[model samples]
Target: MKDHHPHKSLDDVHESVPIHGGKSKFKRVISFFGPAYLISVGYMDPGNWATDLAGGSQFGYALLWVLLMSNVMALLLQSLCTRLGIVRGKDLAQCNREIYPKRMNFVLYVLAELAIAACDLAEVLGMAIGLNLLFGIDILWGVLISFADTFLLLYLQRLGMRKLELFIVGLISLIGMCFLAEMFFAQPELEEVVTGFVPSLPNSAALYIAIGIIGATVMPHNLYLHSALVQTRKIDRDEHGIRKALKYNFFDSAIALNIAFFVNAAILILAASVFHKNGMHNVAELQDAYHLLGTTLGTEWAPKLFAIALILAGQSSTITGTLAGQIVMEGYLQLRISPLLRRMLTRLLAIVPAVIVIIVFGDEKVGQMLIFSQVLLSMQLAFAVIPLIHFVSDKEKMGAFVIGAKIKFFSWLIAVVIAFLNFQLVYEEVTDWLSEIDNVGLQACIVAGALGLFVLLIMTIVYPWILKRKPSRSDIHISFDDLEFKQASSFRTILLALDFSKSDEKVISQVLQYNPAISRLILIHIVESASVKYTGGQSDDYETRKDLARVEQYAKFLKEKGYDVLFELGYNNRIKAIRTMCGKYSADLLIVGSHGHNGLKDIVFGETVNKLRHAVKIPVLIAQ
Candidate 1:
């Protein structure tokens, strides 16, 4: 009963392959090696390349210590993450829903997905840039081309977990080999390379790059990934077996992360040797780095190798990013979506802005975006880190494996330091921009950025403390259908809202099916006003005529069907309009066409049905 809520992690694969080996410590350790390797790929993703390139090109390996230090922190945090999974058979997402109230868990999930999205943008940009280097394709088209990998990811997963791991390891090897070959040819200064491992900040310029490196290296989603991945081996739950698995898992995480450090370090060292040493200090962009590698090293293969490594980095990271999205959605929100759909959803989120940026602005901003994306990842670290520390530190949750005083102190210290560094990065990045943007057309950007960061800082502090009370078992409901059916007959006055989607016609038809004897329907549509007044000065002819005609069709249909219909329209804040209409009409029930968003999006954005349920006191019905 100690593991009362012991969920079957990766329920599909766990039953397919159970571990049986009891002897040979070496062989036992190797089986636990795959998850950390997967997690380590995130450490060397395209986001890291952006930061490492900037650091090495500008400062010539002065900030390598930051990479080393960040990896150390990652080791500690990842170890704690796996302990949660191994001890409780629960990943970080599961632990979160179990620990926090429903409201707070949803918030945490949003922040986690936001962090994933930020990383995805970096991946998309890097892939586009890599394509530009390899084939001279435009970045916009390159971004669109990256979408084709969605099919590749779906196909790979169907082949099973072992094949996927082999595929990733092969890609990781390709990246390492390409970089290893480049680093050898570039021949970085041995003395400077050794000294780079020493901790030093050089100047404020170096600090910015150093902070970027730290942010890039320690990803929030990797924490979630590590916890879930470790459970794939299906280790024995007995005391001796648990202890053995923990020991080997630690070894796996350490070795894999150290190799990740090598990949990150090699990228920096290659940049420092080939670009910075040759007076090309501004090789910050992926395109610039690719071209300069050939120019500086006098080898045609250099640029191609750089581009290949980048493509591998972006592709590998995107695949893992999709996996992380699944773990997060399933673990936090209990929504089991197909990996393909989730991948497409996340890819689209990353791609839409990327496509827009390439179109409106030039593709050069991809480099800037890559750096900024890592900063956003830094901002979200506290949300994942604090919770992992809290849950692992809790004696009740972790039992015999709960963090000790020394571990807890250091873990909290890491969390506080990361959060503080993120705040500083934002402050400096924004204020530095604000100082440069004293002009007319962009003053608003600086002001908005400053305000945004201020709010972010406050959220960083207050977010963890929310939902402090225990989750109430009584709050659980088996089916929304049951609750809605229990009170179906009580409806007398119904408020129905429509957005004029294809679903709206069906919504109207369905409500007419309800066919109440004495009940009335208040049919409403909101034009969603932007400013204080309508754009046409409230006396427009053609546009308002079209809107009126649209509403009349619904009203005429309802009236002809022998039911009373009251038509109304409002502007802005749809939630407030709906609530006001409900109260003013004394409506017993409110019905709206659900756009049917049921994944991370529905949870994050508080979809129409959900927000309505929370906003109004009346029973809300989602029309089929």
Candidate 2:
């Protein structure tokens, strides 16, 4: 292992929430409440509403068993996520990066991102439709307006995780309240509602919607998000503490996900009672559902409540999408960017396709688009789910906390079931596409892409179980508290790289004071003048001569102190040049001055000392 701190998951809020395990039992349980509620919002987002509405309207509550089944699966998988985070101290993305090779991690990262984009597309469309239904805004403008939620996310993040959790829970409560009123107005038949949970598919179309409901309910991104979110609560690492956390997190997931299950069931029931009863079996479009709810239920508030709930669901889910995007990008790629940029990039990916669909196909197509996005999530589900199961079941990594035989069996069962449904859906859809396309080249291309993805999916399913080894524990020992001091070793030959600035005086002063036994000084400067950069030492321009004079002068000043000094001048990339000169002189240490610049300055004007340290093999000392 490398000698560096492991990157934290959801680093802004890692261990930010206090567990308060020493407090009253009720108080201790309350600390575990927020993460699951944040997670549950994803389960009941606009994606769920879209799937539920489509499933109920088309199949008339026949697919409600799918929702129930999906919620149960979500509970199990989310508990596994909690187990992974608490026991391993890493999120799912981080675990994948550590276990899988880089190229493989990249593929998983892309799939994770595609899942987020698909999830966000549902939110974008849901938000836009809510605005359009309530305020009569154009769909394109509403989607364009959805871009502003990036700022909302930024503001909420600044307020902290506890507050963000509060906001999400409030929105979820609002959605719950809205649905309760809808269920009352719709008055779904009790016997038929009971019958919906008997686990039967009415037709092939119902099977597709059933899969969408499963996709929306057991979302892939939530798996990654929950693991990282659970880490926000500060807890003891002892056995009793871990056991306590697992129990409370389980309760948290159950309570929150049950609420989500109710919300989904309510959407399906409302659509089934009002639309199916009225012989309006094709009420899959959200706009159609909104307009029909008022007249069909004979109440004006029905549509109003529906739109309000849709807006809340879309807004709340958008926040989690931002966090998941941050997790996968940072975890899989070890890349971090400003939250603002990340949010914009994610929303933009969803927005462009949404706006294009609305403009080309119009608002009538938005509902299908939403359903398609959920199905896309289903297709990507196996990639995340398989690796998560593999991780939790690994005894070497998880130790005593490894999931037992039952959980191991059921988790893999869930993965297989999801893969089976996705494969069936692909088979049907591909067959339809192939038959419709008359061009041989297009058909060949489609077949090739399908085969390639199938191969990748198979690789993802088997790689962790068969080939991966648990990463070796770090060998380097570190003592944080036990302190020891010894006489400082001095550098025998020091290389000082400088710019023609007054900071050079401070740099030389620091070197002389820090390393008194320095026997030789190699003063070097890299002239970056336009004329000499590409030409290197071959260009003898006036700017190069001026840099030469500055270097010689510095050498002369150092020599006066009775030290042997040699000056070298080079051009082009300063980092490479300094590295070459360091090796050329056999210097033990390289000293460079800080520009006191960071952030945008480092981006625009490169930070030489930072780059030079990594480019060279010797010790680098930065002078303040």
User: By TM-score, who's the top model here?
Assistant: 2
Candidate 2 error regions (>4 Å): 1-8, 94-106, 151-155, 184-192, 297-301, 329-344, 355-365, 395-399, 456-505, 514-593, 596-620
lDDT of 1 by residue, 51-114 (tens): 7888888889887888888989999999998888888777788777776667767877888998
Candidate 1, pairs of clashing residues? none
Best by lDDT: 2
Q: Please, what is the TM-score per model?
A: 0.73, 0.80
Write the residue-wise lDDT of candidate 2 on 1-624 in tens digits: 111235578888898999775759898899888899988988988877767878888888888889889889999999999998888888889888877877878888998999999999999999999999999999899999999888998998889888999999899999999999998898888999999989898888888887667756788899999989988888887878888889999999999999999999999999899998889888877888999999999999999999999999999999899899999888888788988999999999999999888889887788778867876787778888888998889887788788999989999898888888766766766788799899999999989977877888888777776884646321122444456888976788898989878778778997666444456888888888888656655478888888888888888887777778888887888887888888898888888888778989999988887777789999998888
Model 1, which residues run further than 4 Å from truth?
A: 1-9, 14-17, 20-22, 432-469, 472-624
Residue 267 in candidate 2 has what lDDT?
A: 91
lDDT, residue 88, candidate 2 = 81
lDDT of all predictions: 0.80, 0.85
Clashes of each: 0, 0
Instruction: Summing lDDT over every window of 10 consecutive residues in candidate 1, give the lowest-scoring window.
Output: 472-481
Deviation from native of the Cα of residue 293 in model 1, angstroms? 0.9
